[model samples]
Target: MTTETTETTGTEAADIQAIKEIVATVQRTQRAKDPEGFLALFHPDALWTTGHGKVLIGLDAIAEFTRAVLPAANWEGEVTYEPVHIQFLRPDVAAVKVRQVYRSAEEESEGAPLYVMTKRGDGKWLLHACQNTQVQAG
Candidate 1:
């Protein structure tokens, strides 16, 4: 029982760590336009959906989408986030909700954005979906 408990605990810890790494990778990849770097974290059959309602299924489509979006935009600011929740659907999957704050390139200032991320896969957490909504300045 003790050994089994230890093993379960270890697996849970590793799963959580993997999920966090996926979140960090998604963040880094979006900010830097790192397509290959970002795709490395995904599974072969993964799916990606952007806030704009664009859907990219599979690695090929994902790469194409990344190339078109990331490099084309002249983003010049930092991206920050406030943790809302991380719900584990399974040891290998999770749903993450957060309030993202991106520095506004339009005004060269800061803005709040809410984002939802879903994780998938067994060994590593791959971003299954993400939705971003802009926050209006009050």
Candidate 2:
């Protein structure tokens, strides 16, 4: 029983690390403006809500939106994504809260995004549902 518990804990730790890698990839792709690379992190049936309130459903919609906007975005800055929290809703599902920041020589902006990820049977985690919200400056 102790061995089983230890194994389970180890697995969860690995899962958390994998999830953090995904968030790091997100930041990298965003910085590179690689829409396809960014899209690859999502599930085929994923749902996404942009910071501007646009809703995208499924991989097709996400791909279309990303291809249209990501490359054209006019931002001369560096973007960063940090996984601020993770909650395991089930053994194969997790809700991840991310803190996103864009910093340029002139200004800085922040985003709060929540990503619901699911681990596939093949042991890969994909973004299933996500919401990106811009942090309004006070």
Candidate 3:
């Protein structure tokens, strides 16, 4: 489901911190190749989009996808959140823009630009939806 970010002036520091934590958690899990851990940070009804209509709905699908993608080879990378931009939709929801660069065990580093929207659940922020694209250098 698509959501329009609410127009508001002052955003809360706690909410911004929460969003940052979730983004960091996702990157950590990817580096660890921990599917269950990665899936735990997402909402039960999350929509994970990996470009070109590749969408995984629900936590189970996301878990499967993570396991399939992350374990093929030993992988490690550093993801830097360059100028992360957070937009508050409500007190309990936010959208964040992040820039990530990843390097696998055998591949060169590549950058990707992403937008991830998260909802606060039971005092924690859980990713709800995401849109991303690879940053290609010409």
The 0-to-1 C-alpha lDDT of every candidate, in the order given, reads 0.60, 0.91, 0.67
Model 3 scores a C-alpha lDDT of: 0.67
Candidate 3, residues 16-49, lDDT tens digits: the string is 6666777777777766777888788878888887
Top candidate (TM-score): 2
Candidate 2 achieves a global lDDT of: 0.91
User: How many clashes (backbone N, Cα, C below 3 Å) per candidate?
Assistant: 0, 0, 0
lDDT top scorer: 2
List runs of model 3 lying over 4 Å from the truth: 1-11, 51-53, 73-77, 81-83, 103-109, 113-115
TM-scores, all models, native as reference? 0.69, 0.93, 0.76
**Candidate 1 structure, TM-score to reference:** 0.69
Per residue, candidate 1 scores C-alpha lDDT tens digits across 7-113 of: 34776767655655665776787788777787786566767666566777877887888777777777777775544556665555566665566676466333332
What TM-score would you give candidate 3 relative to the actual structure?
0.76
Worst 10 residues of 3 by lDDT: 1-10
